[model samples]
Target: MDTPQNTALMRALAEVPGPLPTSGVVHISLPHTERFTVVGNHLAQNAALSTTAVGFAVRIQSLPQGTEVGIKALAARFPEGEKLIAAALRELEAHGYLHRTRVRLPNGRMVTRTVFCNHPEALLRPRPADASKRGPALVAAPVSTQAPAPVTAPVSAQAPALVAAPVAPHVPAPASVPAHVPAPAPVTPHAPLPAPEALETPAPPPVTDRPVPAGPLPPAPPAPRLVPPPTAPKAPPRPLPQPRELTPGLQQTAVALLSDLRRHAPELVLSEADIERLAPATATWLERDAHPDTIRQALTTDLPQPVKYPAKFVRHRLTVLLPPPLPGTEELAPARPRTVVIPLQTCEGCERAFRSRTPSLCRDCRTACEQPAA
Candidate 1:
């Protein structure tokens, strides 16, 4: 009869050997009785029987009497190999699922003897009711049985004892009288004294008339002299000089000199014609003297201004030298103002013109040009 346990064991074994099937059972006739079994093929030669009830029985029968199954042998038989089988065995031992016994081999070295429980369910089940919990248990005693004694005492015993005792009454004696008692004498009723006489007042003496001496009153203090404060010294007024207009020639010359100085030495000042004429000498003198104010004063007084007008003379000279345009020619061609308009690119960052194509000032000036005029 094939039981469920036998069937499962056979199936596991059959997986190891192809020849063994679920329905196939090998009957091995031992010398004593016929044992029904499964004969696994060569693959089963290395198959391991688990450390279970069925596995134990199978293992016993599978190995020869002298055969010793160690970790290596079990590993060869285990599906996952020896290392995994050894690990599983350790785990089972830790979980109380298996027990191990150490046996001494003939080599004098210790080996393991593993045993498996037939009923794993029983090992995993809850403990019996009679078994105590793992740790200590606390039991509380009854409070009424161990109560303390009362502290109160009987009232009559605690009270003090009182006895009857009599006290004598207090009596005060009367004060004694003096032996010699003298009575006070009676007061006499004397007669009234006479009233005091009135004092007499003397009359005042007669008045005498005496004339008071007269003296002339001194003249009233002389009237204050009204003396006015001294007038401030009067300033001398001078006659005004006639005004004169600058000659056009002088004006033109000044303008020309200013323009020339601006072109050569922009820092020079043209305060007066004399100063302008003496500018170069004054600048030279200042360089030698190291005193610019002294040069300035000398230049202002030393240079002479032109006496005659030059613009009138220049115009007359030009008119005589150059021919006048024809009457129709003048109408045909009116003079156009000649102004040199430098290209923006020619402008140096300075207001002056630059001859080079790549002006140093153009880029800087570009930013200024881009700004809105204030």
Candidate 2:
């Protein structure tokens, strides 16, 4: 802020007391509140008042609600006005002088509305359970068929009918010339009723498929129930990986692997994120029981010089080269024999009741049976 450019600009610019040029002579009206705010508030008296942010804040405060606060509009007032307004707005917000709220309209869209405060005590973060949150003070109530009290104006017997009176019957000229009676002035429609009373006015029954009711509508059908949608069963979450213990050997391997990748493609600037994301790929390769040398060779063999987006390329290559997960020791162990052995059977021919490997008879008996009986 104390730079030479700022000092030179300050020196170069001088205030000339005069009215701003418009299409013609013009004037702006301000209430006592706004005039006091401009003159007495921090916007005009603070340390930042020399900066464009203060001026921008003053302008924002001076304008009434619904005024266009776009960058273009602000640029018309301050030099480099758009950027100035943006900075000023941020400053105002940071200083608790401005904040915004999101309001969903009936059309099912959300919009941000800037809430500026000349004497704001708005906080940056609001508590979750606070009773007051951003919304309109009033919400709309549903319409019902129960009729509102009908407004009745006093009826005069001599009052004219709502419809235009029929044109006076033309009379054949009794005399050669007669004075023509001036036609009555046409009546303009009356102004509409105020909106609050308009809603309160009684409406006629809606036309429908059913004939006009002779009696009352069979107590109008009960209001439709708002049934909640059926929920779908949730899928089981994937298991998270267990933390890896970095032994000296494994750490060396990881470092070497990283070193080899960097050597192959030096263009990539590795970060902790790249390391973390790529760690899984390396772990997968190791879990598949791949040799460190093989991994290095696969990466270095087909690598094109000067890889573009090297981190991603390396990630894809590592994933492509990932070996399947290794089987656990339990899966690969031999099936154990039963502890209790069955008694052996003997051959019927030899009167040996040995437990036979062959079904229904001993091996010798089966062999003998298989041979031709002689």
Candidate 3:
């Protein structure tokens, strides 16, 4: 059976003189089941929103929760540049279809959190209008000409019962008193105060030679416990025993090596004062038959990043990792040679020096001597 509203709509449509115009849009909307978003017509047909903003808003709303809808992400996904996408986002924000806020994460990183609203009309509160200018008055004034019949109806209905009820004995009726009598004037009396001998004064505190302190002065704080000012951290103990008067030549070699350290590791660059100060330690390494390369390796390799105090670091390595002196002859035993070297001899035939195990003529002279006389 057709409902009255639907029937009326059909009749109204039938009364139209001609067929529907073919120029406008026609929707072929189908029931959505799986992956679809419902968008409100207020946003879809909004006159103030630009085409790009409308499309971007729809895309944002359809996206799954936590999906990236930032300007760069959208720009990467679509051909529209970041500028256009950002403008579209701004438009969406202005119209209340989207909100983007920079939020700081718990780990101290900043991120943009976006919120999309499908129905901006419901989500975004419209500015409240001035009551005096736009809204109708909530309270209407009562008309003076109209009688108060509704308010007086209940009282009028109970009038017979009220008139028949017996009045209480304590209750006074309006007509019981004489109308001409005047009321008595109010009376106030003042009482006499007590004699002066009844009042007593408080005694004053006793005087003492020394002034008293509040709460015993906290036991004089135990003379501050004499903390000794923390010993000043002891200044790192300067390289100890100071290399025992190194030679001028040895000192120069050490200084040259120290200055050249920058060639291998740029971070190990040393000032002139630093090089002069560390020269004795470097000379000590050389005195112990430690090669300049070995010193360089020790200082440059495995260096801490940024080497804030390069001179101090070099001093520590030099003092702590100094190699033991080479062994004495008594400590080392001689060993046999692996191979013998041929002695150089002059050839009898050509008088040219050549190496041979046995001193004799050269190969050419030997062959000539062995041949028959010719």
Candidate 1, 174-251: lDDT as tens digits: 486466855546533243221212121233332325444498644444433232222346675332211134445444
Backbone clash count for every predicted candidate, in the order shown:
3, 9, 0
Q: Scored by CA lDDT, what does every candidate get?
A: 0.43, 0.59, 0.73
Quality of model 1 by C-alpha lDDT: 0.43
Ranking of models by lDDT: 3, 2, 1
Cα TM-score per model = 0.16, 0.26, 0.29
Model 1 residue 218 CA deviation in Å:
99
Best by TM-score: 3
Candidate 2: deviation at residue 80, Å? Answer: 2.9
Off by over 4 Å in 3: 1-184, 187-236, 240-252, 271-273, 302-309, 323-374
- What ordering of candidates by TM-score runs from best to worst? 3, 2, 1
The C-alpha local distance difference test score for the whole of candidate 3 amounts to 0.73
Itemize residue pairs with steric clashes in candidate 1.
Answer: 48-77, 75-82, 349-361
